[model samples]
Target: MPRFMGFVRMEEGQGNPPQALFDAMDEYIGKEAAAGHFLDGGGLYGTEDAVNFVVKKGEVTRVDGPYAESKEVVGGWAIMQYDSLEEAIAGQQDFAELHRKYWPEVSMVATLRQIPDEPPTPAED
Candidate 1:
């Protein structure tokens, strides 16, 4: 089985989703989880709450919030098990439709990536 992560990204000033969107998302998550496709997922706070650290030449430097130059930040993520990348993409499309219904004013993009499988055991573990 292939595992995929749907990373939800939103613009810097998009703000938080409305209560209706939250309710809809909760219902959606339940349905997906019940179907056994969804493994784990959750929404995140605004990007202002995030921090960025850059280490160069053994020197660690940190910068405060508003990372990525305020272009876009991940607002949520979902881990799912699927058979193929096409299936993963379809699942994300469905989620986007739900978001469109609830948050018409806000724009978002969901990116999907496959999770690599762990290496096999040596001989006996």
Candidate 2:
């Protein structure tokens, strides 16, 4: 089985999703967890309370969030395992559909990437 990370992105300050979306997600997550496909995942708080430690050269700069100009942000994430990339994509597609059915007015994007099982080869100069 291969594992993948799902980054759920949406606009900042978009507020909460509808109650129906949560109810639908509860059932969906329950099934996925029971099947052992869902490893772990959770929603993240808004950027207001976020702290960023950026490194440039040898110096580190601390930047506080609450970014007023950020139009999109990662609102949540999920770790899941599936037999193949297709299966993982289908699973995520189903999740996106839930939002469409419950909260069609809002837009969302879920970026998926596989967790590499091997170390990368060093590049030649």
Candidate 3:
């Protein structure tokens, strides 16, 4: 199975989706999980609340908000586990359709990748 990241973008000034919709999506996702299609997933707050960072000349610079962007910014995301890229894309397409109905301007960007087996450890012993 492969891992995928579903980055969700919301229009400016658009608040969070309705609880009922979310609950329905949760139930659907739960079914997928039972079928071994889900690994882990969650929502997130607006990008304005996110801390941005950059590196230059080996120095790190911290910004108060999300990094500057020309297009819609990522508002939230989910990590999905699927049998193949096609399956992951199909799932994302379903999510996008649902999102469009509830969040018309929202978009889902899907990135498929392999989940690493271990987290990176600190250098210090």
> How close is every model to the real structure, measured as TM-score?
0.83, 0.92, 0.72
What does candidate 1's lDDT look like per residue over 1-125, in tens digits? 89998898888777778899889888988988897889999988876767778899999898888676677788889899887788888889989988899999987898888888986568976
Whose TM-score is greatest here?
Answer: 2
**44-91: candidate 2 lDDT, tens digit per residue:** 999998898989999999989988888898999999999999999999
Across 16-68, the per-residue lDDT of candidate 3 in tens digits comes to: 67776687788878887898877677767666777767798999988775535
- lDDT leader: 2
At residue 87, what lDDT does model 3 achieve?
87
Q: Sort every candidate by lDDT, greatest first.
A: 2, 1, 3
User: Residue 60 in model 2: shift from native, Å?
Assistant: 1.7
- Scored by lDDT, model 3 comes in at 0.69
Question: In model 3, which range of ten residues has the least summed lDDT?
Answer: 105-114
- The deviation in Å at residue 51 for candidate 1 is 1.9
Q: Let me know the TM-score candidate 3 reaches against the reference structure.
A: 0.72
Cα lDDT for residue 115, candidate 3: 61
